[model samples]
Target: VDFPLRGEWIYLRSFGHHPHAYDFVKIGNNRKYYSNGNLLSYIFGRVPANIFYCWSAPVYSPVAGVVIKANDGWPDNKVVNLASTIILWVKATFLFRPAKDGPDLDIRPNAGNYIMIQSESGFIAFMAHMRSGSIKVKTGQQVAEGQAVGEVGNSGNTTMPHLHFNLFDQINDPYQAKVIPFVFRSFERRNGNNWESVQNNTPKIKGEAIRKQL
Candidate 1:
């Protein structure tokens, strides 16, 4: 619970858009948590083509742990509209495996490209849907926070390119992960230049926006 916030480059959007809207999942309306379960690389904003190919950037380590699972060969799927959710799910189920870290899965077997950090707090951090062959760390290798592990990408059962990040108490039973609420040691809010701190934060929803000090 006392670790540094790992993500900075990526902004967020659509917080708490899913059913489990909460401080850990959504700040207002933006979906803060990863579709599969990894911390994001960027926040949601009008970055132009950034949404499509932006995830190719590297993902940093939230904590130090060995690489438990990773797969990056999969490609990003197109974003889905509200009406086609059922059809998407059906197709995904037939073609992909369920998300290993949550009940509502957005990842598949091998979890695309990912890294698992076994925090000193006895928590395992899972970052998934990484770019193909972008992983920098290896299994059993020790990594430091903010260490480059892989690039964000759309893979597995994900709809687009985005880092799926999460902290798990156990890697074996990912579905039982207890969403740990946290904040950054230093970040700006509302575009302020000063480095500020945040806690128990969620992402901004559609139509709502906020800026953080980077």
Candidate 2:
């Protein structure tokens, strides 16, 4: 699958991280400035949800496939304070653990609004933390690669607005599904003062900006 969003986006909770290393990978696409930017466009003491540049940014399908699941009902949560955000990161990094129960495991609420598409190659592509009521596709709908499916939001267990993407082997249950590693066709990496091109490499660090090559 190709990079799901366009323009320069920082990689966070990316590969090799706790939650991402185990299953999901996250990308932060919006910035106050294109190159060197602040956390929010305009900081008014506390960063509000709408102040985030990524909030409601269009999200696309990474692969041509049939939608296996689509959810879009929950409202986006308010952006938390810096301390709360830090605490969340600590909890996710050290205290988070996947449920061991097989059939009884529940992950829907935690995932919030999302879309799951089964690629022609058979792997399930999952995108979570989408904006409420922004999903444009439905279950069983056919979608092409790069098709706009929804918008980014601060839903689910997130501290800010960003895209949470993952690939899985199973579609029936998220808890039962095993994560599958995938690579982008091509992407741009942020260099010291410029963006560098990278081919077929997975992003690994926070604040690494990447632009998808169409």
Candidate 3:
């Protein structure tokens, strides 16, 4: 029942390069800063600034929680192309460098421009991969449900543009957190019909595309 986002809604490119219905990990979800390797390599690279600045083209708040964390001003890194599997391991071993606080290791964590809002249900909705400098609110600010928080863009450890929305039980521990299931109140779920009213839940196939009834 995971509701993609909370508020009035802004259209964003699905980071999961698959079709409309294929459920998957979005682009920025897995990657390192600058080196273009997967999350493992990104962890090794650890450059915080590999993500660059962008802006929210539209605003939408998934919840009304106060800001627990907001990091901005990191620049994105250039995309890269890795060679064969064997080469990846060899190169990663030699090229992998621990992230440092020095000038070269300035890339911030991959949660590029993002907002963590508290939901009335006692959970937090995390919206990541935001355009840099497009965050409209600040820490401790009370955002309304479905309000505009920021626009979608490729900032953090992303290869393209899209919105990364997820629900977490705890903010401090994201990787260890469990994903919460949710539903949209009045959106139409495509059930072979043009506009089927989906009340509480909907199941998404691997490659199906479903859109909310506007």
Best by lDDT: 2
TM-score of each: 0.58, 0.78, 0.57
For model 3, residues 88-148, the per-residue Cα lDDT tens digits are 3343334444365443332245556777777667777767667677777787788776666
The candidate with the higher TM-score, 2 or 3, is 2
What do the candidate models score in CA lDDT, each in turn? 0.49, 0.71, 0.49
Model number with the top TM-score: 2
Full candidate order by TM-score, most accurate first: 2, 1, 3
Q: What value does the lDDT take at residue 54 in candidate 3?
A: 24
Model 2 lDDT at residue 195: 82
Residue 194, candidate 2: alpha-carbon lDDT: 77
lDDT of 2 by residue, 157-211 (tens): 6666778888888867655778878788788887877788888777776656677
lDDT of 1 by residue, 15-109 (tens): 23232221111122232433432222223221222244344665667665566655455654444333333444455546545653454444554
Report how far off residue 16 is in candidate 3 (Å). 11
